[model samples]
Target: MFSKFVIASLVGLGLGIGVGSVPVLQDHLHWNIWVFVPISGLVLGMLFGWVQFTCSSLLNLRVSTRIAFAFGLVSALAYLGTDLGQYLTLTVAVSEPTEVLSGQTPIRQLISFPEYLRLEYGSRFIKTGTFGNEDVGYQLGQVGTTVTIVVDFLACFLVAFATALVMDDTFPWCQACNRYQCKTTSTKILFADEDRLYDVLDKTTELLLEQSDHVKVNAYLDLVAAEQYLVKPGDATQILSVTNYACNQCDNKTMVGKVLVKTGKNFSEAKDLDFMLSGTS
Candidate 1:
């Protein structure tokens, strides 16, 4: 949906603007040109869009939170580092830099000559790189840099999008299966515990979750669903238990779950460690 795009783009814009405003990125890299912000925004928007699109896998809350944060962190860094990142990927131009910049070790200067540096539709940006300059730069010609930018942004967009659904309140629990699941699909009963959250939740989950789900227990006295979900990925080493279940309708999990117990090895420490979901009551 466009919401994802908008969120990612907005986040990208904020990050790109912030990172681009940094002294090192704008000044040291000499990306202070008018075209730089849009370019950076485009990259960030596409990068984040791609990361969140196809990569969204339903994961445990703790793991999903980390993954979401990872998405933002990578987006920020990537937006800040697109200049050097592209160059380091062996994208240097065939011709050497003709303009020798003084003052700062500018990567290269954008120059235009009537003959060799003619500005045409095909000609947008003249890639320049000095052999020994750490502070690299790009010079824009009157023709402007658009073709490479569109292509580059498209590339970033295509190679993007992956996330996990954690702390989801929209979904419901499977009453027949004795687990939290999506209303439309019983195939999603699998869950896992986030290793990092184990210590934190171990201390707090009991204290915080001991109360009844029906009781208005939140700080704001909101009537919250009293439920916990446990998922075991192929890599899980522990088990999870829950007391409440949402009203989401899904397939019966008994057959599939039995199959899991019968054939699956190296599973979580315990099977059905918690009470079974009450039948449709």
Candidate 2:
């Protein structure tokens, strides 16, 4: 648990520094390093963690390093697959169009009229060669084809190589390697914070009681104290509860009031803590 907090803090700190130092990331996007570095780190860390756990279980690998390597390789392949899919879908939409306007093709074909005719009438157009009918759909670009098998082989090799380099040092118990644990601990902290809030309110009540006279203390003051003392993550309902009580009293007396403003601001701050605790963006 302590390690998770330390890891999250470090990730957040790194983000702050990276965002601040990187002129391109900051200048072009008009976003501070503090805004993106920790945010990006946390999100990336979670993504890596999830992939590690799922792949490890599926492959029955006990080593975190192996899982990270496998997932990183898969990420590379996914990137390649996405790129290839887009290329094929856009370049070879001839056969799959639902609104088949039979007159003319909307996209310019890669195989122009000359190439089409050459293949259509070539004398050696024997039916069993590399350019055979079985391969015709691919040759005509009727179906999308990925890069050559050689290129694909190289891609997989490179993916596996890169994965091994980057993730070979990871440990299963490391905070950087497991996001599920981070989320669980963060949730526990949030709930714990909520449970401890009543004590804070009680202390505030004791102080207010000391200051007030024999006359009834205005409920609004209690609400104000609640909002001001809400320094921790959990128990946001205290803010709403106190604010609602104050609002009800104010409404009956037709008094000028604004519990909502205080509550809204505190709510926004409280919301950030949840993400911070979760080690997620």
Candidate 3:
């Protein structure tokens, strides 16, 4: 768990820095095209969430809500830091001549950080025009800047929070083996009788679970001959998908079954028919 947190924090910080720097660079080149849309923040959050999920999966780390929230917070803070850093660099380091023989003057000498923030944010920073008319403008004052900051942070937080939770469900882990299960085989059967389909799936799962060796499990699976249940898609009312998973380092195995019912024009998974079984190989 500690390792997971450390890795997540590093990843969040790195990603935030990489993303935040792009806009600053663009601004320097006078080629900035960033539009502060809420949806853009959501998309960025999801991208961050995906990176976090991928890292956890690769490292075999279990992800929880707490870790996800921490990652979100770190990412948001790192991104905000870029903005503050840019402001400070401009105000404190960059100097402008006051007048002839006067001296170099830095913006820091005239305004503090808080005052600078209020003045800069209160000014019109973004403006867009259509063919010949002004179409959009953003002149968020101090109050609006505060609101925007909160909204942006929340957008990054909530989307990442939800994304991590959702992706975790798609992958199953073996607690006993302390690893992720690998899919060994999968078969899709078109069936007319739901009872027969269930019986075949149950029997297959039982036979595979009884074996102690992966080779034996594979041989038994072959004998089941799922192809015999295949039929034309147009003639089938339901489809049963059976997937087998096994832990490579141990004799643990799992079988997942899902049934899809054909509706008017599409097939939808039947939640009632979903089942999972786990046992020794």
Candidate 4:
């Protein structure tokens, strides 16, 4: 298709540009002014283009400029998001507790004890040379640093280009979507007599929970428990049927009703039985 061709061309162009910029990037990676940084985008473009061409042909989709641009944009955005996410996780170094004084009396005497305390939000405190009079309050200000504007713009451009090349509406598992979705991998592609996907999910969830903070673990445990109760083992037919049946009920009442109708009053035997899972009914 014409669209496919455009995608291919743009990807090729981007890849060429990126390949052209590598030496420049190498030169500036260690420099003071970031002179060679511009080439990173070009390199990213070229690499994205090659990937797009290979995958597009496999999927039987035509390469197009629109596709390339869309991929590029998405890729750039994904990179940007990842960068920001890393910054958020890593920027804060140390935190300490501090108490604030409450209201004082008219005579300049202390009226009440401190009601609350503040802790640094993973931000660091720096020690600079003391002045004639040292101010303790000014130390927290040293922690927050702003990311450069040039870096942000470059990230966006790369995201847009990469997104265009790699995204496909049909693939639900793609990270391009705001929701947590995953594409069906080879393991999931072929249907077998027994389904091991839940086993995989269980292991993955366990690993994730082990690494998560207290608050996150609590929330994740609740969700994982709920999901476990809803899932059943069987062939694809049973799995699909159960999934569809659960999805169709609008509320707890509806879900209960559906289960009763389908399971012939065996719903009482179900573990972790909750109407909330079916829907709002």
- Give the winner by TM-score: 3
The candidate, 3 or 4, that scores higher on lDDT is 3
Q: After superposition, which runs of candidate 2 have C-alpha atoms over 4 Å from their true positions?
A: 1-52, 91-281
Error of 3 at 185 (Å): 5.5
lDDT of 1: 0.37
Score candidate 2 by lDDT: 0.33
lDDT tens per residue, model 2, 1-281: 33432343333333333433443433221111322122332333343344444444333334344434544454433333322332223333455445543234522245554453343223211122345445332131212112222233344335543443443322222234332121110001122244345454454356444643211223434544444563554443333222111111111110111111125435333432211011111
Tell me the whole-model lDDT of each prediction, alpha carbons only.
Answer: 0.37, 0.33, 0.65, 0.36
Worst 10 residues of 2 by lDDT: 180-189
Say which prediction, candidate 1 or candidate 3, comes out ahead on lDDT. Answer: 3
Each candidate structure's TM-score, on Cα atoms with residue i matched to residue i, is 0.25, 0.24, 0.62, 0.25
Residue-wise C-alpha lDDT for candidate 3, range 1-281, written one tens digit per residue: 68876786677666655664564452431112353455545766787777887777667777777777776776566555445554444523334454532353445566776886566546435566555665576665666566555666678778877778777765577898666777788877787666766776676566545643445544544554455445667877788776888878787887776889888878999988676767774
Better of 3 and 4 by TM-score: 3
Per-residue C-alpha lDDT of model 4 across residues 138-197, encoded as one tens digit per residue: 333323411222453365456546554455432222122222122211111111222443
- Residue-pair clashes per prediction, in order, are 16, 4, 1, 45
Candidates in order: C-alpha RMSD to true structure: 15.3, 20.6, 6.6, 22.4
Off by over 4 Å in 1: 1-9, 27-145, 161-281
